[model samples]
Target chain A: MSASDVTRAIRRMAHEILERNFGCVDVVIVGLQTGGVGLAERLVDDINEIEGTEVPLGSLDATMHRDDFDLRPITSEAATTIPVDPTGKIIVLVDDVLYTGRTVRAALDAIHSYGRPKAIQLAVMVDRGHRELPIRPDFVGKNLPTRRAEMVDVNNDGVDLGEIS
Target chain B: MKALRHLLSMDDLDRDDIEYLLDLTERYVEVSERKIPRIPALRGKTVALVFFEDSTRTRVSFATAAGRLSADTLGFDVGRSSVNKGESLRDTIETISAMGIHCIVLRHFGAGAPWRVREWTDASIVNGGDGRNQHPTQSLADLFTARQHLGDLDGRRIAIVGDIKNSRVARSNAIGFSKMGAEVIFVAPRTLLPASLEGWPVKVTHNLDEVIESIDVCYLLRMQLERQNDAAVPTLREFHHEFGLTTARADRLRDDALIMHPGPMNRDVEIAGVVADRPNAVITEQVSNGVAVRMAVLFVLIGSRLDLVEEQSAVA
Candidate 1:
């Protein structure tokens, strides 16, 4: 996708989120570490612009809760920061790309330890097919499918599809 | 940089390694603060506790860290093994290695024993404490806890007082704190200090009174009760009078100055009982951070390389 397209999607997603949730009084926007942080921040900015009210923002890294820990080594990519208890609040989990859905699974496990959220909805900039787990994104910017080994990298500039050298 | 296969000493970690481990400890600290206080980071892994000395906080801290990460622990009963059956350290290590453990947290009465254990086993070795050599995790805990209260340790003055010669905590903290840009001062009776501070990166003083008010962190070390018999001090009372954190000395400290001790403390000999009750005393927080630091160390050791198990198997 192009830069304008990405921006437009984020803006529209923000409006859709506000309309569905009825103004975000109980909403917490949690972005996945590294990849989703910038996107989440942008979404929160858009939401704030629309509602004139700030939503609690947090970033989470799910390396600790990953099921593939034994098969592959993992490192904590970033710090998890939730400003308030997520109990009884709607958690809008954001990620840059939704592929295997394993990270989302791990993130679900990690979030449970904090507090049981009233509900969790996944938001992704791109939803590429090839899911190994039963997980789906509630909000999407784009849908692009490719071979398993191909890489999908999303940034503020745009989305790039390429091989990882 | 390649991640460490063994956390054997403070010397094994450079500034980047120390910074990474401590930063990672912050995340574990957050996990600890959560309602569940647990994670599955080290799931399907096992860490063997191979302690050859008496311990309380360090042992319990390691066990708790492992449990929070969902790692299983196999504790070697030191009481039944070498002391009774006369099996050597070599014999015990080999036995644990044969059981296919992933990591070993070793505490021994002899210095550099963890290095020898590293040679005997492919499982990663963490120097829980080996004599007066090093206790890197405890140092990490100290750094984490101190940073929590006082922010960055950079340019901060820390007075590590009492039993300097016999303390592994002193050795580790001296290196660990100095590495983080803190100015470290070693205070003790001359006899309790190592014969020379020739190459040590710290200031040495026989007086705590001079620096007490000026220092940012007053770190008290336990006065090993056995030291009195060894004639290091004429009496426990003299140690208290001279170097201890008595009410008078405690009163001399800056109100915001931090008080830290790596625990199993000598209540009256090193730190006064009432002084420990004060708000600035962060000895309890040190114990709490100890578990988080240990969890970070374990996560670093176990999850450092994704193909570690494969590499180990291929090598074997």
Candidate 2:
């Protein structure tokens, strides 16, 4: 995927989000920590451009809610900032890629501690097919079939696929 | 980077480590400010608070920190537990670790208790307050509090007054402050001073009034009457007259100087009652910062290690 392809995908996703939520009212965007933060910010900018209004934006760190916490080494945590009340609002969780669906699950658990939202929807830049959990993205920029050993790198430049080796 | 397994002393951490923990503490402080001041950082993990010595602040702070991180806290009761049945410290620690605890916050009457416990358990050990040896977390919180009030600790003058010989807080704070580029001065009577400041990087002074003007932080350590004998001080009144932070002495201190005490203060003895309540006093802030600092320590020791591993695997 090229830079133009990424931009076109984001524009389409932004339009779909605005259409589904009827002009983005009561809709808040939360980007997952690290990779998803940039995408979430971009989405918020795109949505504001279309709707002529600002959407509540936040960044979530799901490290604490991960199931394999004890099985893996510890990592430095990023900040989780929700500037607005998530209760009675629609939470749109944004991430760079969708792989095992475990991260989305963790995000779901994490958001509960903040406040109970009316609904939560997942948005991803790339939907790589290999989900361990029964999770699906509400807005997908690209559906890229991937092998378990392959890695997907998504950034402003584009999305690139590489093998683990 | 790999996370630390145990915090035996301030020596285990460099300036970077201290700064990292302090920076991480800011995030925890933010978490504390939230409507729900709890995080799932340590969910499904268990921490044991083993206090062989009686404590009110350190013990409660560690427990509260663990709870705030969503970790189950197991309080080891030395009064009613098998410890009273003459069970060895090693055995007690091993028993706790055998129960599948993830971390141990240890406070023992013996110095180096946490270090010795490290040998018996694979679980990470955080030193709460060991016998006149080191209280690394307390120093971390103290540094955090000092930095909050004094801005930067670099080139800051801190005088740790009273009971230097039997203060784990003093030992830890001296190392921590020096590591962070602060100059430490020990102000106490000769009998209260340690016999040797040979390798210790701090100055010694017998006069409180002489150094009060130049110091940025006057950190007062509790006079452990239980730990001292008659030889340590001639009389309480004489000690108060000579080295105590009396109201008159406090008046002589610089307006910007901070008055700090590691609590349960002997009122009008080491510090005047009114002085502790002054605006320059950050004693309460230090207590609150203790929880944040401990939360940072536990998070790094247990949760951050996973992050390191993930980064390494990604690089591989």
Measured by DockQ, the strongest candidate is 1
Q: Model 2, range A1-165, lDDT digits (tens) per residue?
A: 998999999999999999988889899999999899999999999999998999999999887678877677644578989988788999999999999998899999878877889999999999998899999999999999999999999999999999997
Q: Chain B, candidate 2: TM? A: 0.97
Over 4 Å off in model 2, which ranges?
B1-3, B149-152, B231-257, B302-316
For each candidate in the order shown, give its overall lDDT on alpha carbons.
0.89, 0.90
Question: In candidate 1 chain B, what residue range of length 10 has the lowest lDDT sum?
Answer: B304-313
lDDT of 1 by residue, B19-71 (tens): 88888889888899988989987777899998889898889999999999889
**Residue pairs with backbone overlap in model 1:** A73-B306
Q: lDDT at B219 for candidate 1? A: 96
DockQ of 1: 0.56
Which docking category, incorrect, acceptable, medium or high, applies to candidate 1?
A: medium
RMSD per candidate (Å) reads: 3.1, 3.0
